[model samples]
Target chain A: MASSKDVIHSKLWQEESEPGDPFTATACYCSGYDVYGELLHKASYVDYLYLLFRRERPLPHVARALEILTIALGNPGPRDPSVHAAMSAGVGGSPAAAALMAALAAGAGSSGGAREVLLAMEVWTRCGCDLNAWQTAIASPPVATRQLVWPDIDHFPGFSPYARDVSIPVRQTLEALADCLPDGCARWLLDHRQAIENLVGLSLAMPGVAAAALIDMGITPEAGEMLTLLLRLPGAAAHALEQGEMGFRRFPFFSLDISNDPGPAMPKEGTAR
Target chain B: MNERPPLETFEGSLNTTMGGCFPGERAVFRGHDLHAELSDSDWIDLYVFGITGRRHTPSQLKVLHAIWVNTSYPDPRLWNNRVAALAGSARSTGILGISAALATSEAAIYGRQIDIAIADFLVRARRAIESGRPLSEVVGEELRTRRSIGGYGRPVAKSAADERNAVVLAIAKKEDLVGGGYLKLAFEIEEFLLSGRWRMRMNYAAIAAALALDIGFSPREYYLYLLPAFLAGMPPCFIEASTRPEQATFPLRCSSLIYEGPARRAW
Candidate 1:
């Protein structure tokens, strides 16, 4: 049992009591911008993010790759759990913050979100960056029959309903991004696209490409999910706001049977436990 | 093979005071063999023991369970429950819907954070009173720093009589757990706060915090322990809503929205 004093002082990061204002700094400004005091005016948001995470400016190709990945996964449509949760919250007349919170929670799951990408990244690492080894392992006897044996690990993060037939522009953008980057995970993914598709029986999803790009850029698996969350936030906000504005409470197309008993019965007043 | 990180550089140890499970063999809970030694134990008892690394008497467990049961409202109007219902209405998967609801349930105003704050306050206040500071002065100092105490106020309603609070208090009294210093001080603070025009009453968060603090659970432990309390009733809401016509739970119309923005313009 830690005493109150011990608990309070044991925090890992304690801000200095007399630290100067955060907005205006003498040395390095926001996200390591110290050159000529003019980094903010010139750098793009992705460049700033790159500096913030990696503590250095991104290569042009790296910046472009991040931009492409971010745009590719910007909107997963209303069917995605996060977007649907946001719209549902909006339809219920919840405030914007509440809707956003619901969306974030939905997006934090192991399926159809960043957690899936994290799992895929873990599998990639576990396979020692060898696609052949991964394919062999998944294709072997006992594991092959299970299909989804590993806990919390999605064997294919990029397999989506639309994977079989990706839009031409999206494919072209991915191909273009692949051409600009070094021969790392992203390039490997592009190079072995058909093989991966044949093995998984689905085309690569944008999230899989994003995960490879993130790993190539030196982002860890844990941080990858957070980056994915940040990327999806704007799209979530948009869906929530749109639902709050233009949508009705009842989604027009969906249909199901309403339950008579919605929840557990509350203990009657004055009843003994 | 990938090179493993140096073991000497690790910040922590391999041993955990918490429980662990072996795939098909056994589970060790709080240093005890769960299967052999504690198989007959109550689920809530095992849960508390696993979390706090301390065992509670049956009376204490009863009171704790009662606190959770009392706060588990089945009504979907609550914030977390609303999230669950909305998830169902949107036809999302069970895990996504429930996780979303649980995540939103950690809100500052009406959720686990408030309970954590309350527990932290009670622990500090108890220590202050033990150190010779008067209860009123300590409470007044706290109020001076923050406008309203976390556990004391009921924002939506004005009544002091809450059914859940009454049930929790009754259980505490029956279990002989009501005489603790923190509980006493909580009552004193409630009296002091209600002395003037302020209509704030001691709600479930305050009572639960005081009880938990008295039972030797720290503020952080109290927060983690109480995670499943409100969670128990949330799933049924999601389950029920999923069975209903999609987007039917608390359905609204576009006309219901009050737009205060500029006149519609082309993009």
Candidate 2:
């Protein structure tokens, strides 16, 4: 007998009944909740998303806060590299999933990326809302770990040194989310928003804000990373799909500095090079 | 509904000295004709140029090519390649299969992360050396933190030796490309390990990173350039698995899963 080489384990999820019977799932439990039978009609999608990670249905305010942040991060638009990655696949007629994969890969870095959110969430774990602690940590950032492929944080992951002025939407979203979850870290972030912004010479980017929101919700950094990626996905998916139909002609191609090779110097036919 | 982002949010023309398409006319890549002038150029040359904006000599390009070639392990049991095989097994689109495979290539224990770690270690080592820190002390600090250096150890079931290192270094030697700063330091670390308590040999990624550092790939550039290093092996895995049967890529019997967690119960 060949001994079992791999074993699948999960406390977060399980499904009863095999597929292809009249009722494929007799029941599906998510962290002990009867997902389809009991919680299907009762729970909101955000609540369900919360249960998937946090393993419990959230309080109403927490659900609302997640929804607010979700709406804020839904679509980062075309110029955002994550969205642009998806659009590249769309324009090139590549497979649909490539666009999102491109988004995830491009968004894995520090500049408004998921890893930045992960780092920010880790920061939240270290220093909750203490201005002095934030300052000390920022001034003497820890040496980056070697296990990850992402680059070292040049600036604090949450704060962007390049942002000149805090934009309207970022501030609005922060205030809205903070209002919803007043007792959580979001409020702490809200209270100290300007002070930290002044200290860093700029406000929190979306990832930083999202990190604070996740922390306030009692979400772990690991869970926060997933949520940040999940929340930001709407834009990447929507733009990639839209760009897929627009094709390359109607899009911005050499609008500046028109050249011979939209690929100008074709060798009668393009061969390999 | 939400308000639009500020006008100057990502302002500035998306200009590039890199590549751009002219639509129907021609494509520009690093100030050269994509088709007309550089049609005879090897693909790897064009790729390396795209990364660093500097053309490499044929000798350099050959070693770079070998670095990619030796990594084309078609076995589906490997982590990243399994995604491709499974994608094909499910009859998924090539784009999804390849993209998912590439995405999963950012492994913690191996692959691109290892390259990134090696490059980063080399950089930090150089800086510490420049700042008058002894080489051994820096290595000691890193070893103490990370347990072992990133590219020096492997999951040595059969032998601790890295088989691919010989082939790649041979190409580097054949091309007279062995003499590079980071490469020398990489070997020094390996030598240090050999003499010390942790007797680990240099793996392929360590040398590749050293060569990349010598060949003038800034850590970020090297990171970008090596993103698709395992790309060549994916498509074949996808095709082979897909052509066979649905759900047939390495079929495990249902009983193969030994769930040690909780007993099956109703929700």
Candidate 3:
């Protein structure tokens, strides 16, 4: 079974700097999908490509976009699900992604229509994928090992559970985007940063601390400090902290003294040199 | 595409609903249902018949207006997309309902006039947005002009909330008494129309709009306004209203006294 980390890396880790056009980006994302082989990390990549293409055209092109998607997915890979830990989550082609691609392809005939396609592609892709989902997963801790399976061509599965389970890397990616995209098309990404992060963290299979680090980076340092505090709590509080279920707690992080060392002093009002 | 009904179907239906037409191809009248005549005064009546209480939100009313403007005239798809964009923005931003039906319904109304009217009603219920006057005031005033021709009375509520809820509740009750498959079908037709795609080798909206004009609004209005009410009654499941049941409550809301059925039996 492919792990979440492998899935994400396969779809998004290509070394290419920027996709020249919608077709190339889509092609890049589906670089690992092959009909006869095990499903590759094509989930996000294919989804990303559709997102790009969708910005440029109407949804009618989805069938065609998907055709291109399948073609690209069908071409690459050694096809071993075991090589990728990322393959653990969602194994299916995203319906929303397919819808987007079909809409794009249906608009202008699939040739020389890059400019319009590119313009439209920018609208949906500007925010990147929803990230809060990843973060939520990462802030959560691990449990028993289980068999991981990728979704088949027709169905995409394993989204919700994975999002709540994984935490770290997902948060990192979200932080990276929030840090980078705030001024442009990415502003929307921040709105659902929590959800996106939760999805990403789970999809990527990162540690809980990694998620905390990401939240710290994307939001405030104080939030990071609080998460760090939660990690040290005893019994269910600590467990809940690791699970990203800090909602039901009875006390504040400030009240708990996890570490034996004294914490950083609070800044006084109007301090001078 | 070459063999579509003329715009006259809509106009003719409007004429019949307002006055003479004994259940002809384009008219259906219930009682002295003068609601059709209100169109002459540039007013449209909203028949809400169900729940004793619920009301239409300002935003819902605003969205309705946008839907009506885009659907009521030619190029309903164009308006549908624009309204969908607006509605999508509001929904994604966490400002309104998060379900697909309302969004789909709002989007579907673009090319079809009755759908447009419902959307217009939604838009009208909103407090004045961007524009200075509230949409409800605008629609209500316009509706008043139709009162002499159509015979629609004002709701009993003095407050906006009371009036809006009365409308919503009325529509809900009517929908519960009758099945709401027609509204669902209308929603589907609108989606196909706004999609601007030709499917089954046909541009669905043109077909839908023509049919809408032929069957007209009185039937559609009752069906649409009552949709929310029906949905509330039933639990969630995929709705296959158009295909499963061959017989439908044609103009379920409107009476045969005003308009007729399809101009061509094909529909």
- Relative to the true structure, candidate 2 has a C-alpha RMSD (angstroms) of 5.3
CAPRI grade, predicted model 3: incorrect
Tens digits of lDDT, candidate 3, A1-273 = 223332222221222223343212222212322311222332334343433333221132333333332332221121211111111111222223222222222221111122112221322232234344334433442221110010111101111222344345444443444443344323344455445434433232212222222232232233322322222222222222322332324322222222222212232467541
Task: Identify the CAPRI category of the predicted complex in candidate 2.
Answer: acceptable
| Candidate 1 chain A worst ten-residue window by lDDT | A141-150
Per-candidate alpha-carbon RMSD to the true structure = 19.4, 5.3, 27.5
| Model 2 error, position A163 (Å) | 6.0
DockQ of each: 0.02, 0.27, 0.01
Ordered list by TM-score, greatest first:
2, 1, 3
What does the interface RMSD come to for each candidate? 24.3, 6.8, 36.5
Model 3 lDDT, residue B233, Cα: 13
Which docking category, incorrect, acceptable, medium or high, applies to candidate 1?
Answer: incorrect
In candidate 1, list every pair of residues with a backbone clash.
A249-B252, A257-B243, A257-B244, A258-B244
For the record, the alpha-carbon RMSD of candidate 3 to the native fold, in angstroms, is 27.5
TM-scores of all predicted structures: 0.52, 0.84, 0.19
Please, what are the lDDT tens digits per residue for candidate 3 over residues B83-162?
A: 32333433222112112333334322222233334323323322233357643344446446532101111122211222
Order of candidate numbers by lDDT, starting with the best: 2, 1, 3
